[model samples]
Target: MIASVGLVRYAKCVLFGASTPRPEPDSGKVDFSAAAAAEVSVPADFRCPISLELMKDPVVVASGQTYDRESISHWIASGHATCPKTGQALAHQNLVPNKALKNLISLWCREENIPFDVTESEPNAVTANKAATEAARMTASFLVETLAASKETDAANRIVHELRQLATSGSDVRSFIGGAGGIPLLVPLLSSSEPNLQLNAVTALLNLSVLEANKKRIMHADGAIDGIVCVLSSGATWRARENAAAAVVSLSGVHSYRRRLGRDRRIVAELVNLVNVGPISTRKYSLDALASLAGDRENIRRLVESGVIKVALEAVEDADSADEAVAVLAALAKRGGAPELGVQEGVVRKLVRVLKNGSDSGRANAASALVYLCRKAGGGNLVAELAVVPGVEWVIWEMMASGTERGRRKAAALGRICRRWAVAAEADRLAARYSDVSLTVASSTRMAVAQ
Candidate 1:
């Protein structure tokens, strides 16, 4: 644990840049205390232009601009494509790590006794836990004071780094943070123009959102929804999109919050776009958010209007995401605006496929969706034959009507299902054939021949 702590501190410091907040030395204090000069003085060339800290892992940007590697990475990740100092278009953005500068900084810190207490380790769990709690309590207080005391982005950056570190510790740390006024402090940072702050703020919130108490508090926080929506609106950075989506997904699990989340069309649009084209993990989070929001019938209307059902059709065909896609479809399938679009996009075939070759839970969801579709078709509205799957409605209806009350379950076997073939056989417009041949469901002529 001690070794890991040192590595993290080293990594955090390596993000040094000149653009960061630097505390100006007080000339009055310098004159009064001669030792202050010795404490503050460092070789000028050793500092990063962006952070003004002695560089740990220095690197050169494409514009011949030298900066710490982590700092430059944060800059580029915030959607900067050009040099921060020169404003010149970079032919490419790359950081070539400077090993010589790193070694020099290590040697310098060693000589200055800077590594004297990088981490406090007592090797006793109880003692370590107390120390960590005290540190977290103090750090949380510092953040509250900093935000209230000054309007400095750099200072905020440093505070957010600690918030992120604490967040990564575990849910217990996150609970500690929520009690320390971390959620409210973290909410405003999501609107920050600083990419690094926005990244960590959202990450910290996400880590805490696993607690239902934090989720409710965060949802009601001022500027929270708008801040998250703004991040989703930014198509530029993966950090913003990924973490913001994750935060939304976490907060969205609370049943009461679904209506408010679904009411935001921009968020809904962004989620839809993400599903159709975002990174794989982003797609999963986005889909989960949409599915939860689909709890509201009006939100389901919006999702259908966004043509998500078609995207869902495509998503269902993929093995990795099939269950998640099915979950979303099931959520939306029972609503008015969703059914026609789903059927138009060949959802019947997809649902049947899910029913045939899905896990018990997946199959139940698919079967429920199929039943909902059946009810929609049979519900006083005349749906065109081509607009619906030919015999799936008949199949689902039969299973429900004749499914026995035996042992609290029925239709667990195809034999029970075959007995209900008589229902399909008796209908004049339908042609149902059953044999002892195979146990597959043939909802249409094509399916039967394929079987």
Candidate 2:
């Protein structure tokens, strides 16, 4: 029995290693398998159509399609004009956050034992360092308090300028400023007579308006639109007016705000006036605001009545402003302004030049505007005119052969109209020639009879 026991002990020692416990897996480290992750069934709605992956930040485009913010932004930046999934042309490129969807996605991730940091997914949230973000928040709070207590004009300007810088730093800092009640304080200074104070205050509001929440806050604040319009209409300096226009653009991102702004005819008139006479930069900013507001029918009417067509026609002739000008024209055409555009002299010719040699976006807009104009003017006259323009038909043919999907559609429509007009004209000439030949033959027969 003792020999058997010794033999058993020796066999266990050789096979299993002597007196060593099997090391438990390190509790701190968990190994996750890629295959296992692949096997996880993510909901379809949780995935971005462009990336085909779970969305970290969901944003809804004007087409009402929800996509990952980065993915949709890249799509728009790459010159795509339509929604990826629905293929509808985007009315505007505003990417409103889908907070409810984001919350659902976060909840799903937690339930599935996946790691997702919601705060890290903010569109402009500064997440590189928690300590730095906290410091910025604290600093913003202090500045807001100081600005509230400040009675000296020089000191107020300096403080407002600092707050503007902070607001421009990141979305988090803007949120902090808004949270600290900085918007109300800034609104009162928008109409300040002091140039620097007015500039700084309007600029600070402009910077803070970048965040969606701050946009609402700024819009709803008492006399905010009035103040911004005041600055835009009669600010002491061009830079202040430019930023005031920019702020209007930012606020008009929301549809309701656009309606409210449309109610104020002065806003539209001021922007039109700027586009007519302001410097290059100010005109550009004014054009941007006008473009955003042009989405509403009332705003389009306001723009037309304010003489936008004349300035837009002039802008189309200038290379610096042609693209934005064409885009605005297209928007107006889509929204009941086509008749006015059709009445403008040389508008068709200018658009033809753009179609031949403008940037991709400009070409697309020009094509769209021309099509709308032709349709509104009764295709025959405009189509005949277009068919005769030097190289216009060739440009249309090329666009049909090779262009973006939307561009191709517009080009094909224009080409069809032109071709139909050409064919009809050729048929009429042939028929007239045949009639003249028959009449001459009859005259010869009559002469022979007389002889």
Candidate 3:
């Protein structure tokens, strides 16, 4: 069986022109010809062992074998700690990005017209299939070359712009970029002490992660999430904050990573601060990240203690973010033990306000938050408070009469619980349920978020 398997493997390799040259044990000289193919031909050394494709990004393991960055990242995230090629136990999980090899492969790619771009302008407006097809055309080779440098600030800025464009371009582009070793190469930039470089790298990763495969690779890459959280917990420009938060949102969405992510108080605090005062983009991502983090019940208290509830209440006033904010608030409430925190934070009134005048989606989510807050053990009494809000009954009735199917169900359910159950009242109900509570905690959190 073993001999037959070897024969089949050899046949496959012969057919594909894909095989790694093995070095003899105890021999100091490893054959260099196969891996050292000239720019005119693809180098076998550039191909990842797992994917059997030329590696755009290569990383070495403890066993001294190299594989594509995405392949290895996914393997690590799935709980393996062994070299794919040698099956040797990994000494550690840290991945050292292979910049030199990437540089060589990138140079070769440029020469082959495989295309890479670091653009100042957004080329993102194109569709994924279109961009993928067009990838054979000249890529912004200048940007590609710029990325290979360690200290080219101007080039790095353009790298961010072009990466963002490609991220938005579509799946094919992201798949191509990921397969080309883009994620592995770019992830190191997130850890740079230079704030600009970190910002550019994170923003690019945030965009690149829209591609499904890139998400796994970005999450497990050494220092990627930690660096992003550092920027979030510390201070950066609003754009940087927005980009960082956006990246966190993407990473936190993966369930396996959320447990570790939720334990970070800095992450929750900064996201709460961003929810309170960051720009719309930042707020949106923070809200989503919070929602995902809340999935871990252990993180709920820290989130509430960090002022997440109050900031989320205030966020309802933003037309663009109200839906997401309310959804996050609902998730927090449902997480157990944190239901009362929302009531104390004035979530009831903010939700009522959303139900009264927020867009359809916002109304539904707000209604959901209100229902959870009023029905939970710690918050059941708050149902009466919400019942008396001037327009509460009217909003519920309005939803049942004209809102979306899901929204109407939430409104109807809330009406029944509060005994303000009538779908008939038209009085104004959206009002502040309580003044901001424990501003001391929130104040301290804001300091961490910005200072």
> Poorest 10 consecutive residues of model 1 by lDDT?
27-36
Backbone clashes in model 2, listed as residue pairs: none
Each prediction's total of clashing residue pairs, residues at least 3 apart in sequence or on different chains, is 6, 0, 11
Query: What is the lDDT of every predicted structure here?
Result: 0.58, 0.74, 0.61
**Residue range 142-163, candidate 3, lDDT tens digits:** 2344456536655565565455
Task: Write down the TM-score for model 1.
Answer: 0.57
How far residue 64's Cα lies from its native spot in candidate 3, in Å, is 50
Per-residue lDDT tens digits for candidate 2, residues 1-451, read 4334334433443344223222222121111112123336566457664434467789888655678886588568757686654335687898888898899988988888777768745443343456566667666777788888889887787778667656655566778999999999999999999887887788788878756778889988998988988998898888788778877876776667877887788898899889988877577667767767776777778888888888888888888788768878887887889988887778889999989988655787788888888888665777777788988988998988876556777888888777778889999999999999999999999999999
What candidate 1 gets wrong by more than 4 Å, as runs, is 1-135, 147-150, 335-338, 356-361, 379-422, 427-451
Q: lDDT tens string, model 1, 1-451?
A: 6334534443444354112433322211100011122354444345553333355567766654567564466557747576543233466876776666666766776776554222321232312466555554554555555555546777777676556654544344556677777788888888777776776677667766755667778988898898888777772366567567766665665556767887888888888887787766566567667766775677777788887787777878976567667767767865564446444646667877776566443554566465456456452221232124456445444545543222012223322333344344365234333432233443465686888
Model 3: residues with Cα > 4 Å off, grouped in runs: 1-146, 149-151, 156-161, 191-196, 296-298, 317-321, 342-346, 378-380, 420-451
TM-score per prediction, in order, is: 0.57, 0.71, 0.59
Give model 3's clash tally: 11
